[model samples]
Target chain A: MINATLRELSVALAAKRISAVELATLFLDRIQRLNPALNAFITVDRDKTLEMARAADVRLAAGDAGPLTGIPLAYKDIFCTEGWLTTCGSKMLSNFVSPYDAHVVERFKSAGMVTLGKCNMDEFAMGSSNETSFYGPVKNPWNTDRVPGGSSGGSAAAIAARLAPAATGTDTGGSIRQPAALSGLTGLKPTYGVVSRYGMIAFASSLDQAGPMAKSVEDCALLLNAMAGFDSRDSTSLERPAQDYAHDLEQPLRGLRIGLPKEFFGDGMEPGVRAAVEAALAEYRKLGASTVEISLPSSGLSVPAYYVIAPAEASSNLSRFDGVRYGYRAPEYVDLADMYRKSRAQGFGEEVKRRILIGTYVLSHGYYDAYYLQAQKIRRLIANDFVEAFKHCDIIAGPTAPGTAFEFGAKSNDPVQMYLSDIYTIPANLAGLPGMSLPCGFDAGKLPIGLQLIGNYFDEARMLNVAHRYQQVTDWHAQMPKGSA
Target chain B: MSLNLDQVERIARLAHIEISPAEAAQTRDRLNAIFDLIEQLQAVNTAGIAPMAHAVDVSQRLRADVVTETIDRREVFQAIAPEAEAGLYLVPRVIE
Candidate 1:
């Protein structure tokens, strides 16, 4: 039962072979056994789990179940849950319980899904390795000493450990894909505004997108079908009609034109990751896909640009937490302003404070045009480069990260080294292009290497089709780290 | 592009985040390194290029000014408040 894909789990539920309560209990037991080491979950309430599962079972009994109904999934802590703590991995929000469901949570509830608990993330979604999370870093299931990539590291690690069959993640500059790559799960980040951002905690408004993370492309597609749609609450939400993101999962890949970015394949890549990505491309060739070399000249500038833009937005968004209305407050203060300063200074972790300072410096009177505005122009060039390349290729392919997961404190001391880990995955977010990552092959040390597929704007269905075809030909996505399951 | 201690202090004040002298010194070093990374953007020839706010070219959607949400959860909202008084939030005196 634990080994089944999301589709098989749903099938078993429909056949009455397993009840939702039983499934939730099974996972809850596994989490109890494994969670101490991984630190993937921040909140796990068995009472709440059984309550939701009981309702899901009632819906299943009435024959009113959707494919995901009664399916237990992990919600990234970034999303607001009505009563659950949505900390966004910061002490600032540690005690803040949501008053309403985020748009994504509402949709999942409507589908009659069971929420297992809130998964951990980086503090305000600011770091690459999950170490900045107020809770603790999530360990890679493959190796206890190494990190699971972040800020969606908990979601990725949960799925990798089979704690949750499927989960949700938010990507602002590769939070979803990079973590999924390290933890060996299938993760997708839809085109911007494709998924509503109403309840998800704001990171970089323009770059943050909520999507699915699961064990298989088919599972991710099914979750995306529920997640992606128009929402009036989010001003930027696209007004496009609902899409069945899984509609083309079985499509053939004959004549698929794959563009390999020259910058991504060159110097920065680790040899093991390069070899794994090459092997996956070879598999695609056998499936009748042709590869072409392409250039995204300005993509190398993505890290700098993203740092400026995301933090500028985050500084503004996070200002709402000024120790007054909600969240942490200084126990003692000389005045209201002193309260705000002390609370925020103490509430936010080191990386969050660093980014806020940088944001304030850039958006300040003198530096706005030089740093913020200049980076936006670089952002335009990066997006334009992708637009030009897409004219010749159906999809772009690359290694999701330069290397496999690293030990804690490896790059945490140097933020630039940490930022470069996301160099390959950031371009897609900058372009608002749909991107997904799945296990291509494992490194020599057995860590997973993710094969990234970047599609044109709103081309998620085709990209999933591309991924599903490759998944069908390879067993990498099906492999698991050594565990009792 | 580097940020010195005084600039870091002023920026922290501007952002409303308090920092000790020790933290400010460490922050200056880290912020300087980040800015050095960002300095590479200046190397690009971006004259007359429009700054991109969003990747997609969609404008903000307009909605009617009429009230759409009536949840009226001020009670729920204030329930999480660190301090509240008379159905309003309690805070330190802003004016003398």
Candidate 2:
């Protein structure tokens, strides 16, 4: 059961081989035993989990089960689950138990999927490492000393540790893909509007996207089917006809054209990661797909542009966290202004504060044109680069990150060094393209490396097809972390 | 383009977040370093290029102005709030 895929679990439940309560208990027990060392989950309620599982069993008995029904999945704490503490990994929300459910959470509940618990993450999804979380940094299950990539670090770690078969993640700047890469899991960040972000704590509304993190591409594909849909609540949610995202998984990869961006393979990538990616590319060549050298000339500016635009939107979105509303409030203050200042100062982490300050300064007087506007224009250039490159290939392939997971505090002090972690993955978010990371191989340090694939707008099925084919021929995605095993 | 301690404090004040003098000094250095990285945007000639505010070009979808949330869950929502009084959020005294 621990090694079973979501499909296998569904079949087991359908065949009356396992009750939802039993399945939930197995994972809950595993989490209780394993979570202390990994620090993956922020909150776990066996009673709540079993209660949901009992409902799933009722649905299964009534023959009203969906493919994902009765399956257990963890949620990144950013998504507000009703009655669950939805701390976006910040002290500002450390005491905030959500009164309502995020649209993503609502969909999963309606689909009958059991909620395992909420996973930890970087505070407000601000940092590349999970160290910024108020709940403390989530350790990589592979090697506890090394960092798990973030801001979806806890979700990545939970799945990597086999504590949860699947987890949800949000990506604004490689938060999903980078961590998935580091932890040897498959995670996809769908097209910007593909999944509704209603009720998910807003970081950068334009860039934040919620998607699935799991063991295989097929699992991610199935999870996306339930997660993607239009919602009246989120103005940005795309109003498109719903279709099966996994329908093309069995499609042949013959004549597939994968774009290899020159900027991705150039300097900045470690030798181990590059070699692993090259090997994955060679394997794709053996699968009847060809590779083309493409250029995204403005790709180098993605990190800088992202740092500007994401934080700008974040600054605007996070302004609602004043002492008045739902979050934390100062215990003592001279006036309303002082209350806001003290509450925020004591609530937010250093990285979050840094970004908030950067956003404010850039949007402030005498600097908006030079900083924010210029970044926006460069964002156009970055997106245009993708448009031009996609004309030559069906999907883009590259290393998810520059290297494997590093030890804690290795790059934390140097903010620029930390920002560069998403160099390859940021361009996709900037372009609003669908991007995913799957385990290709491991680095010299035995940490996982992710091969990233970026699909054109709304072309998720093809990307999943390509990844599913690759995963079928490789065992990298199936390999388990030693500690978790 | 680098900010001094004074400017750092100014930005902090504008953001409505307090920063100690020592924190401001360190923040100024970090912010300047980040600006140095972001300075690359100035070199790229974005002349005549339209700034892309969103990935998709969809217009804002307008919903009916009529109220949709009929449920009165004021107590439920305010249950987790720091302070509340009879369906109203409480804040520090603003009136003299």
Candidate 1 residue lDDT tens string, A66-166? 99999999999999999988899999998999999999999999998999999998998888889999999999898989999998999988989999888
Query: Using DockQ as the measure, which candidate wins?
Result: 1
Give the C-alpha lDDT of model 1.
0.92
Q: How accurate is candidate 2 locally (lDDT)?
A: 0.94
Candidate 2: give the clashing pairs.
none
lDDT of each: 0.92, 0.94
Per-model interface RMSD values are 0.7, 0.9
Model 1: CA > 4 A from native: none
Best by lDDT: 2
Regions of model 2 farther than 4 Å from truth = none
List-wise, what DockQ does each model earn?
0.89, 0.85
